[model samples]
Target: MKTCLPFFLTISLLIPAPASSAFYQWTDAKGVVHMTDDAHKVPKQYKGKATRIEVKEPARLPEAAPPEPGPAADLAAPAAGRGEASVPGGHDETWWRAQFGELRSELKTLQAARSQKEQKLVELRRRRAIFQRSRDRAAINEAEAQASADDARIGDLLNRIAALDLAASKAGVPAEWRQ
Candidate 1:
């Protein structure tokens, strides 16, 4: 019995373990339900409804590429007759200036939009107050909806402005220019 036990143990150790896989379930727009093991197999229309039944193996990321030669290489090989200050990352001084100008213009436009949205919100609030005083529920509701929409627009504008500022900083724009 002892001899048989060791052999059985060795056989069990030699046998390959079962591979783990994932499954997903989803409902389609037409109210049809589907199940799949592969994420790629799930229908595009039903992607939002997909629920994973099993944990999927984490995808392996590709190895990072080696760094390219820097400003030294650019210095070694003079650009033919291009009278521009070229940076290491292929962005010349002119490009940076242009990008800064564009970003500033966009920032100005978004600021103007935010100002308009704020004004609209103020008007909506005034109207809402008037409607409330006059006991008009429908008008008040409409004003409230408009105010909410304006608020959302203002929020979006603010977020965009913040992102633009971050980008400007990363682009090496002068602090004064970014402001």
Candidate 2:
């Protein structure tokens, strides 16, 4: 039994252990992405869209190697230390999302509002011009006030957008994401 125990130990040491984890990805109805290790946990409706992601075994290295030099490579240095990929300015994907996600949503809504106001503003300007030529004091004042209010509102929206842009630029956010 002692000799058999040694042989079994040797066999166990020689054999590789099977992988114990897996990952699956799916997007929900609200467009939020989800990831889980258990396939059975996913909803029945999402099963068709769920994708199995094979987790590759990390290569066993004797020593750490130096990263290559480049824009992305330079950025990867911080990401490596943080155990994740980052953008140019040492900010990871989650960080960027935290910073810009709500701003992006607000920006979209504001831009739409600005577009509608702009059209109304143009019409107001034309009406204001007509009122000016007619030289009617009360009508002219009302037209001018309406036009000014619209102009001021439009300016405010533009300044807010510009501020968002400036903040993104300072953070080294990508141009595509600035919108």
Candidate 3:
């Protein structure tokens, strides 16, 4: 009973932080509809017209652990990959389209790089014995180090893509736009 008390308390504390309860939308003088998580941000004049929309965000399941690499590209990596910087203009249609285009292009580039790295890593590992006998152990070590860096970079690219997807989902962008 004592252990369960702390566990329940922790869960209760964490639940409200990520799950936004409501969204407030109001129009500015320019007729730009602005949506925000905080009601306080709504202008005094527009408060009466502001719509308080209660949103029930979908439960996010914990990410599954990445599996070991296999002989083929059929593993769970995205058909495309991704890269740096957070996309902006959450509610703007033009921005959303631009963000989607940029993200998809970057993803494609990263995916190509990922494929190249996978091949390079394989070849490096395969030539381990040859490198060992050539008295160029440093070269082999350098290749191994590069492989590690490539893994980290590829992982980051994948994460950036996932974040974009999450942002799009939250903004209620069309599913087809993500493709």
Best by TM-score: 3
lDDT of 1 at 27: 65
Q: What value of lDDT does candidate 2 attain over all alpha carbons?
A: 0.54
Candidates 1 and 2, the one with greater TM-score: 1
lDDT of each: 0.51, 0.54, 0.55
Error of 1 at 147 (Å): 8.7
Q: Which regions of candidate 2 deviate over 4 angstroms?
A: 1-10, 18-20, 60-64, 68-179
Q: Lowest lDDT 10-mer window, candidate 1?
A: 59-68
Model 1: per-residue lDDT, tens digit, 66-172?
12233334433333245546432234444434444554565456445544554555666677676655545565566556545544443443344445445545545
lDDT of candidate 2 over 56-169, digit per residue (tens): 343332223221222333232355366555454455544444444444565456445544554554565577677665545555466556545544443443344445445446
Deviating ranges (above 4 Å) for candidate 3: 1-90, 134-136
List TM-scores for all candidates, in order: 0.33, 0.32, 0.41
